[model samples]
Target: MLEKRFKLSANNTTVKTEILAGLTTFMTMAYIIALNPNILTNYGAGGAELWNGVFLATCLSSAVAMFVMAFLANKPFCLAPGMGLNSFMAIVIGQLVATTGMGYVQSFQSMLCIILIEGVVFLILSLLNVREKIVDAIPLGIRLGISPAIGLMLLNIGFGSNVYIADSNFNQFFVMKDFFGALTASHARDVMTDAYPVMVLSAITMFVGLFVIVVLASKGVKGAVIIGMLAASVLYWVCDAVFLGSNPFASLATASFVPAFGDMASTTLFKFNFAGLAQMGWFTAVTLVITFCIIDMFDTIGTLVGTASRAGMVDREGNMPNMKEALLSDSVGTIVGSCTGTSTVTTFIESASGVEAGGRTGLTALTCGIAFLLCIFLAPIAAIIPAAATSAALIYVGVLMMTGLKKVNFDDLSVCVPVTIMLIGMPISGSIGHGIGLAMISYTIIKVFTGKAKEVSGLTYVISVLFLIKFFLAV
Candidate 1:
């Protein structure tokens, strides 16, 4: 039955391979199960009940979305509440709370309404094939640049550090003058010596794990990254036990493996408040919706194209098979996620892990969906996997994604210039949309000024103008 449904054999993959690949993918991205709830809790302002609600919502929504992807798209992609989008939601919620003097629950309810509206908008776009048209309208140069740009962005995130000063409430990042000043500061040695050893150890562990994954991958080992992450996690556990004298499993003792049904029912399940939409004003609501739609659209597009390219799913023209179905799956995931009280659930680039692990059909996604369901009972175990371990997987995946850069045509200035800007802008701007927007605007300008405007499609021109407006309004 599985064979006929997923065409596993036709895809040159077996049930075993698909299951292993799914497990590998789940291990790589499972940190989100805990991390999402941690972020949404907002330093306990939401209270334990809300925290538990978001946690349950995260798991259920992710599982449902992954299952939808499996059956509807027959693709090996897993959907989850996205990292950047979640962070953006937190910030927006905070702003709303501060500006409107509303309680956390009300602010959260309002944000859910916004996400619900955004999901509906996306569903309409997907149904009308507008989303697919936008994808097709993107120039080949910009499309090729998206993967490498995201690669650099991931690399930047993996290596960046922040220092917390005693008096300051916020973390002080080492950027601009602070980064260069560290080179000659008289307090540099003191700062290094006084720095927490755990931070240093974490960084070292991440690099070592990343190195191990790279070596194993080079040797053609299946699930090499997952193995490396597990090994690195063991090392971290040992270090914590020896140096901190802490019981590594102490958290498990306090964690509730059983679902908190009362908490989930009380807080956020179908508790969305559309009344908050009127409070946000028409302009704010519209801008927020547009922002979410644009960001989520491109993020999904980039992940689908980048991972599909690596999986050999993209054709000579850079189009993936069943893209509309894949996109529909994404939109449906977002809608379900919002209704369940989480952020936008979209296709994860970490799906590339399963692709690299040899997943080729919907079976891999089904496996992942089942794994997510199991995780509802294993939250404690999932929580124990340190960020340092998953950082290694991200770094390794970023390295693999950089291979897309070689496909860009650098000989032509018009193509090269926009692509170069996108490649550099993504990491620096910390936004895929920003990178693609800059590239499109530049590409249109260069083509027009160089008397090659006819080469640019009408859709490209329309998109370029929209991007220009987005940037202008952003400023």
Candidate 2:
């Protein structure tokens, strides 16, 4: 039944392979389950009930989107309340509170209304094939650059932001950018205090896990990512127990296994405050909605194109099959997220981990969706996997994706400059959409001034102008 549904043989994959790939993808991106609620609830200022609500919403909405991607689009990508979008949603909530004199909970519900409108806009665009046209509008040069750009972004996450050590005051120290980049070990020690040694352990664990996966992959081993992650997780556990004098599984003793369905039901489920939304004024609401739409549309498009390219799912012209279905699934995710209470749900770049693990069909997505549903009851178990372990998978996947740069035509200044900008922009800006936006603007400017204005497509021109306005002119 599974094979017939997912066409496993047609995609040259087995049930085992797809399932393992799905697990790999889940392990890599599961941070969202805990982090989304924390960010959206403003570190509990919105109350514990709100936190629990967003937590279930994150799990439920992500599962819904992944299921849609599986059955409707047959894509391996997973969806979640996106990291950046959630942060922006939090900001918008804060602003709405300040400007409209609404309470935080009221403002949050109003923002959900905004998210619902944004999702409806995306659904309309996707069903009308406008989203597919936007994808098609990206130049071949810029399209080919997406994978390598996303690779750099992964490296940024893996090494720069993946693992952090907290001080006594709860200040974060990034292992790579803070510890190793410190003037000296003593300087790092002074800043991180008792947390410095944990940073060292993370560095060692990350490299060990990365090397393990690399060696296994070199030997053509299947499930190398999961194996490496398991090995690294065990190592982290031992180190924490023996050296840090802490029990890694101690949290499992007191962690709640309940789904918090009641919190979601009362706090966030179908809680759209249209009165508060109207109080925010139409201009503020419209501007925020447009911003959300532009950022989310391109972010999803970039992740799909980039990861699909890395997985060899794109054709010669850099277009993926089932593009419309995929975009529509993303819209569905956001709509469901608003109703359930979370940020915009979009495709995650971490899906590349699964693709690299040999996932080739909807079975992989189905498996991931099931895991997300399971997380509602087993969040604690997933949380103990150790951030260092997933860092290894991301770094390894990034290294592999960087190989796509060989296909770029560096001799062409137009392609080289835009691709180069995008490659750097993704990591620095921490936004796939912003990176692609810069690439488009650069590509369009180069072509227009070089007597090649006629070569640029009409939609590309319009998108370039839109991004330009988004970057500098939008209120």
Candidate 3:
């Protein structure tokens, strides 16, 4: 049935096998149920209520994409709010808000509008088959560097969430001696468990999960990610009972079926007030939008390519099978995410976790999508996974993403300089789009000034010009 839908050749694997693989893939990525809401709520959309809405939207969008990819396109991939988009939402959009004096809500709405426009543009480009032109226009090295750069940026954000970097107004830096000192000291024992226990248990969950995957992989066990996640959940439960003196598992075991859409109903959607956008001016908006779209497109492409490559899902052409369809679905996913109340829809590098676990087809994406769909009923259970838990996973994912740096063409100044700019600028500027724009501008400058002018294209020059105007305003 799936083979027919995705136009797969006969001799495809049995449906039963595909189902198991897909569900395993889904379980590995289940962490997103908790992670997305946590990140979005930083903008003041909070409570179980707001998170419930986010959970529903993520599940629905991802499911639609996965089903299309699986039964319709035969590609194994997942889609959600991508790492780069999240950074833009948290940092770049925040900057926009701060500079414009618009409240966070208004800024979120604006960013969403921009993302929606970007999706429409992407859809047009894809349908026109001009995507390959845009992609091929960029140097292969730059295109290749995008995935790893995104990985690094994600790692940077994960670190920022887990570990604080304090600029103490002095050259020296130090830890607080303990991360939980403030919590424990302020509450004077109001914490459910002592800070030490919480940290130790969370660490235990993390390390044990890592160990399970590593050991299982060594033994050729399929579904290592699922095993690892289950192991971590069990450990978390045990530690909760032993140290926290309460079994959180029981409370979390209840089914979750509530959709959080009502909470967001009062919020604006699809209503793009051109007034503020007009104030920014068409040139500026176009420039910013172009920069955002290019970076996001490349960043998402790299993620899809890299994870697919790792999964052996790439064809002889180095393209993921059904690549066009995946991109189409992802483009639409971004638009829906924006309309539903979030940042740009992007491919998560963490999906690599699922790939690493032996998910080889769209079934993986389908499984994840279904799990997300079911998450609407399991919201409370999803919430119990804890920030520290997914924080560890994201940091681990970030570390994995940085491994791509080894594959970079370090000897080529053209590649090395731009890639390094992305590596540093993403963390420093706190925005992947900013880092990419700077790198493109720098790349153009190098190529142009070095008399290698023929290597640069008119579009490259156009983007560079636009980037300069945007970056100056942004700075």
Could you estimate the TM-score for every candidate?
Answer: 0.91, 0.99, 0.75
Tens-place lDDT digits, model 1, residues 1-475: 9999999888998898889889878887887887787787685678888888888888888888888889888999888888778888888888988888878878888988888988899889988999889989998877877777777776665555211222123434332223334434455334544333555456666878889888898998877877888888898899878986768789988888898868878878888877776788888988888888878888898788878877888887788898888898778878887877889888887787788778998888889888888888887887787767777877787788889888899998888999899889877877777788899999999999999999999999998998888888771
Model 1: how far is 348 from its true place, Å? 1.6
Worst 10 residues of 2 by lDDT: 179-188
Model 2, 141-186: lDDT tens per residue? 8899999999999999999999998878898889788877854888
Scored against the true structure, residue 464 in model 1 reaches a CA lDDT of 90
Per-residue lDDT of 360 in model 1: 92
Judge candidate 1 against the unseen true structure and give its global Cα lDDT, from 0 to 1: 0.80
Better of 1 and 3 by lDDT: 1
Q: Which residue pairs collide, candidate 2?
A: none
Candidate 2: Cα lDDT at 140? 94
Best by TM-score: 2
Model 3 per-residue lDDT at 272: 56
Which of 2 and 3 is the better model by TM-score?
A: 2
